[model samples]
Target: PAFTLESLDGVPVSLEGLRGRPVVLNFWASWCGPCREEAPMFRELSARQGSGDGLAVVGILFQETNEQSARDFIREYALAYPNLKDPRIDTGVEYGVSGIPETVFIDAEGVVQHMDRGGLTRERLNVGLEKIGVPAL
Candidate 1:
């Protein structure tokens, strides 16, 4: 199921809002070290494509951190993209997220195109973006 959540500033965001753009929905936990390591890559990707056509990166903070912690993480990383708080883990379960740092690539039509179940390197991210027709920066 497609999911929706609120950003730190209470903006409503949903998979539908991302339609017509390739989206990378990442499930992560604040306590996961691997998640921490891969976060910068996601941040960079989002920043690079934020103003580009047909590309978006939505970070889903899984059932791990409070709103304050999630906001703190975003600030610390200087992440410019929107981050969603999935406190109930419903979105994670819907996306079959079994662990931290899992990423799902959704195409322009909101179809799940690819799933990466572990840490994401720059190369992996580029490959996924390329697959989804999002030009790598």
Candidate 2:
């Protein structure tokens, strides 16, 4: 179930490309209520984490209608991280995401450290960050 999904802006993003870093892979949809609720928190965490220091916040758009919808969602939330489109949903299947707003924390060694199946708060996100060997937001 390995994938190299393209970002809204057409940038290629892959797990292999982000090998050395701890990854926060969030599966969400524009139309999902819980996903909307946690979008801002994800944005804040992405801003705080940036793309340096061996950490990455990657948004995997699931069950989204179109690229424009995903782009609009990202713009509305002011998200700085890459939002990748999982059209076939194979990536989501591999991650066992049964619903929107699921999150997977992958450690530096490419191990799945934590899996959360709902909207995330700053506190819960901090715990996941800690589990993946990163500083809390």
Candidate 3:
């Protein structure tokens, strides 16, 4: 029921594995225009902070057609971050997601620090990362 989604490369990724690291769990749908617009920014932030210091960004695709569709979206956006297909919307419901483009910031201790609904900008993400002690790029 917790965050457990396979990465594009077929790696098993779970929220538990991201413990002791600051995580940004973003819920998105390929059909959502706002999600499409903000996805690139999220990808950039994830790539910039992916390595050392345990800054993790995991994407959950909501209402996706299938794994291939999700994979295609990742490729289309050139998203380098790990993504999981949340077809049943289980993760979304657990996080109280009301709609697409909901971003939740989880701290190193796995506590939910901030929740943002709708599109996000690089500036907002930087502030959220700072709040979680992950440092901005």
Q: 67-92, model 1: which lDDT tens digit per residue?
A: 77777777888888888878788889
Question: Which rank order by TM-score, best down to worst?
Answer: 2, 1, 3
TM-scores for the candidates = 0.91, 0.93, 0.87
Report residue 100 deviation for candidate 1 (angstroms): 0.5
Where model 1 places Cα greater than 4 Å from the true spot, the runs are: none
Highest TM-score against the true fold, candidate = 2
- Give the per-residue lDDT of model 3 (tens digit) for 25-113: 88887777888888888777777674676788888887776667667778899888888877678889989998889899899999998
Per-residue lDDT tens digits for candidate 2, residues 1-137, read 35799988889999988888899999998888989899988887788675565788899988888777777888899999998988899899988999888999999888899998888888898889999998887
Instruction: Give the whole-model CA lDDT for all candidates, comma-separated.
Output: 0.81, 0.87, 0.81
Task: State the displacement of the C-alpha of residue 10, model 1, in Å, after optimal TM-score superposition.
Answer: 1.4
Clashing pairs in 2: none
Q: Which scores greater on TM-score, model 1 or model 3?
A: 1
Any runs in candidate 2 off by more than 4 Å, and if so which?
A: 50-52
- Displacement of residue 61 (Cα, Å) in model 1 is 0.8
Which stretch of 10 consecutive residues in model 3 shows the poorest summed lDDT?
A: 1-10
TM-score of 2: 0.93
